[model samples]
Target chain A: MTSAVELDHVTVRFGAFTAVQDATLSIEAGEFFSFLGPSGCGKTTLLRTISGFIEPSEGQVRIGGTDMRGLGPNRRPTALIFQNLALFPMMSVAENIAYGLRVRGVSRSARREVAERLLDLIALPGHADKRVDELSGGQKQRVAIARALAVEPKVLLLDEPLSALDLKLRQHMRNELRAIQRRVGITFIYITHDQGEALAMSDRIAVMNRGVIEQVADGRTLYEAPRTAFVASFVGENNAFVGTVAEADRDRALVTTAAGPLSGRNLRNLMRTSEAVLFVRPEAVVLGEGPLTGRATEVAYEGILTHATFELDGGGRMTATIPRGAPVPKPGAAVRLGYDPADALVLPREGFAHA
Target chain B: MHSSVGHWLILALPVAVVLFYAAMALLDRRRAPGARPVSFVQRNGIAVSTYLVVAVGVWTVLLIVLPQLYMIDLSFRPRLPPTQMGGPNDVYTLENYRFFLYGSTRSTAAWNTIHLKAFALTILASVAITFLNLLLCYPIAFYMAKAASTTRMRLLMLMLIAPYWVNEILRAFAIRVLLASSGVVNQALMGLGLVSEPVDFLGLDLGLYAGLSYAYLLMMVFPLYNAIESLDRNQIEAARDLGGPWWHIHLFVVVPHAKPGIASGCTLVFMLTAGALAAPQILGGPRTLWFTPIVYDRFYQAFNWPQGAAYAFLLLVACIVFVLATMRVCRLSLGEITR
Candidate 1:
């Protein structure tokens, strides 16, 4: 909570390939910030750059107002929990935790004492003597957390540490990881290709793609208002429409869509003309007798909500998210669908836009 | 290129068949996870039989059916008609091995024979060299696996392995020239006034053994390289990060991970040198007697077909024993070490 890490237009390149490009994000003290993306999206590269595993091709990384240039990973005020966790197979749990302190020349007795306390903090009080190879997956995860925290780093970096675990365990670990991070009160720079993990854990998330940061916002802001189509499509499900603007004015626009006329409020368009792509969340779309009539083609049961894709008479597929317990129409049933016109968040279609 | 049409057919036919089978397997896998799945008897029967047949095929091709039928049968057959010596069949006996084991009155016994000694020395030397080679190769391998993971590191690795381009015999002879009395090593020493007279290294056994060792060093180097190369560097780094210093890191991390590599490399070097006759004969002079030479002498030098076959069979038996021992030592059946 006492330190903030800043990446100043940082870009990382390996030979000819750019891993991260001109990424500038300011993470506040004690904030749990996540870099979220699909695989090969450079979110991991950004996290590594922050950790000093990589030096930016163009700018600087700063911690607590100090330039992190010329600092190696070991020398930085950071501790990184690698994606694989990378726990030493040979050492006992306590010795693993004491690694950083030992590197700093602490005495054996003192390091062990600190390790025991950290072990307790991670909720595994008596596993200090066990080799990492002997511990279960969850225990090993806790030990990795304790080891990273042992150095008393100002910032902790995690790279998809839960990706290897089963779904149930991963869900459980998220709560544990969040609780641990909260207790530690250190800035956490977490990276993952999982949107659910990123959304569930982060105070804020930076959506990245092809070596560029697409958007940096809190989970709610990101979910409710994604600035780009990629972020909207990636972070959550949204049905999109390519249509010409039937009308455009201040705080309102009517788009003549494939499924027919649609109007929305407060939607911005940098496009010169009406032929722009519009995006609307499936949940925002309401189902009833309205201007548009389409046959329900499919229904997907998601335990809580049923997602129905409707094929309109005009040859366009529009989806609606209805509550699972609701009176769902059978497939091939002709139905009318509508939505709150104000909820349609129109976005420009740019192939290279940072979504 | 030698089998142009045949090669293309060989390549394409297999790939097409594999693809077709793979598609079938995928469909089966997907269908198995569904309701009213494929019948258990049919499913399990195919899986079991396919694995059994493949395993049997591999065993026959590599072991069971091939050697006993082809090579052993070749050895049992006389190179010529043997009716004069014995019955029409010239019944199999230890005579071929006896001639190799105990040569003609003029020739020394197999133990005393120079080529026999050289072969035995080569086997023993290759094994001894593997232990020492690990010491040198480990660090280089570690560097390639961990520190030099960058482009420049990969380039440096290519450079290290580049020596393989030169023929192995040329490399051995190069060492021989350097060790020669008037060659670069002696000349440099004399120029440095380290000795008043040239050292007689090449005319001796020590110099020859040294050449043989250096020449086969690359053999150990590559296998050891592959072992160390494929090692997950993070495992070692993880060990080090867990407070392991320079030396213990290897004991706890590097060495254990490279065990399979070590065993395989050792087996390769040991087996190669076990049957080897050329390197020692060229470098170690006439004093060394290798086993392969005894078998050859019994076959060609002496008119003893039975004893020669026996000697060849004995050599083959020794190799088989070694392979079996290697399997046990390397824990091959465990499927981790060799793989």
Candidate 2:
């Protein structure tokens, strides 16, 4: 029941506003893919388009290599788990799980058997007789997933399904969802604004902003080698140093900033614009002994890591995360910040200026 | 102390009904094993405060119990003629109700066919109206509650309410005029050559059906809308995404979710339509004689107060039975329907 999904130059327009523009990607069968973005960044829109709830104003969405043009959500070989779970409150868990089979005109006994099997798979065995409202938040989530999977869809689309749970349950359910996806071996298109969820669960992530996919790559690549300035800033917390390109090489660049010259990898080939921003994660920024200097403005104790925000002498703020037990500079103390050139990425600032 | 046997039965009847209700509630509670055994006051939440208990007791007696007791007493008495008004001969009898099943003592006819036919026809017509209202209102209610945008829903609500502003009598008269031989519908039909001549619409009882349904349209719409509006849009989407066709989506999801609204709406419409007098009188065919009209004639034209009260009580019992039966058929409780 699993298949690959491909989007070819997909464009969705609502009146004059383009929600998703020219999105082209192919998801391999059984891969866990996610569209990660901030709110209003078109990630949900893209997921809806793939699920057939929305028709693309411009291109084709092919599932299992078949063009899904003009197909309604019901006709598509796909199932979506809504953000709210949307479990039919009136029905018992077994009835809710068996809803798809019942609609397909399966025999009552056959539906019950399928529902029992799905219940066991979700680790919620013997929950069939219970009402949806009686289940805990996590149980309800598993029931929702079980409900969607009961249809045996070729592709399963989840729209921020874990957003409603408390943080502890959310983290737990994330692993459970990934395990379920692996077991089922269906292409899963997950949409989330939470980067942690995307990074922890997805095999690859498409970071989107303002109707455009900034980059699509594995979690490690997205974190280590973001191709766009928006991707670098959005996927994780980073220190951005706006400057001009002083020297350029095949894979490296020297940028002149207010803090003086900084050299880093040329991820986006910013030599043409000359204007670029050097991005370095707070962890990558070495403190205590370095050439760059700033005054520590704020310190936050965040369990394992102690974060210190510094007001740079040359310009904007830069943050450094020191292990909780390590020596941390107090607020108002002068500090030095530095990072190796390999840890910093030089991306063109033009696209990020509006963001 | 000098009250007649009818007065004692009137008081005793309510006590008997209350005892039966209590016994039934006990039996229902027993049927569900492992359920917590709750006393009457606790089950009704009347134990929460003395004020609540007193309020409920007073409300039941004043608004519900007293009126029925008085009506029952009225039904059992004979209607005193003008000469015998307020005299000792104004005593209790079963003659009023006997007139319904059997003809008057002077006639010796086996049964009263006219009143019996009127009663049967009224129940059938009310059932039809209730069924029709549901068929007509469900789609509109669903559209307003789930599909339409905020602005469009507001516009639709205004449209639903606009027709009511003209007043029911005037609206019924308007429909009556439309069903006339040379009215707009017939004229248009004849002009379009669909019919060679005007159709006698009133003779078919079409106008009465239309007017009664139109009269209770909002009663059906508002309840159904309230229930459907609270249903999560995601449930419908989830159903659709799972390969459910449109009818299956409604059958498995929307219909079950909207059961309370449907039950309440159908009950109210059926009850109101059964006791309806104006719509039937204004739009009914010359041969049409609804139960309410017969009761009205007994009370006013014939000046037989006892007979009218008896007929009215019988109709009330029928409405109550219909309401209970609907709740049972829909698998909804009174509390759920009211809510």
Q: Kindly report which residue pairs in candidate 2 clash with one another.
A: none
lDDT of 2: 0.89
Residue B130 of model 2, lDDT score: 98
The sequence of per-residue lDDT tens digits that candidate 1 reaches over residues A1-355 is: 4248988989888999998889887899999999999899898878777777677889999998899997767677887887788876656899888877876779999999999999899899988898888888888988998988998888988989999899999999999999998998989999998889999999999999888888999998888888876787788877777666777777777777777877765355543365556677888878876667999999888889998999988777889889877878799999988787777766666642422
DockQ of each: 0.15, 0.74
Off by over 4 Å in 1: A1-3, A90-92, A99-111, A129-134, A267-275, A301-303, A324-326, A352-355, B1-131, B140-174, B188-209, B236-252, B263-339
Highest TM-score scorer: 2
Pick the DockQ winner. Answer: 2
Candidate 2, CAPRI quality class derived from DockQ: medium
**lDDT (C-alpha) at residue A119 in model 1:** 89
Model 1: per-residue Cα lDDT at residue B77: 40
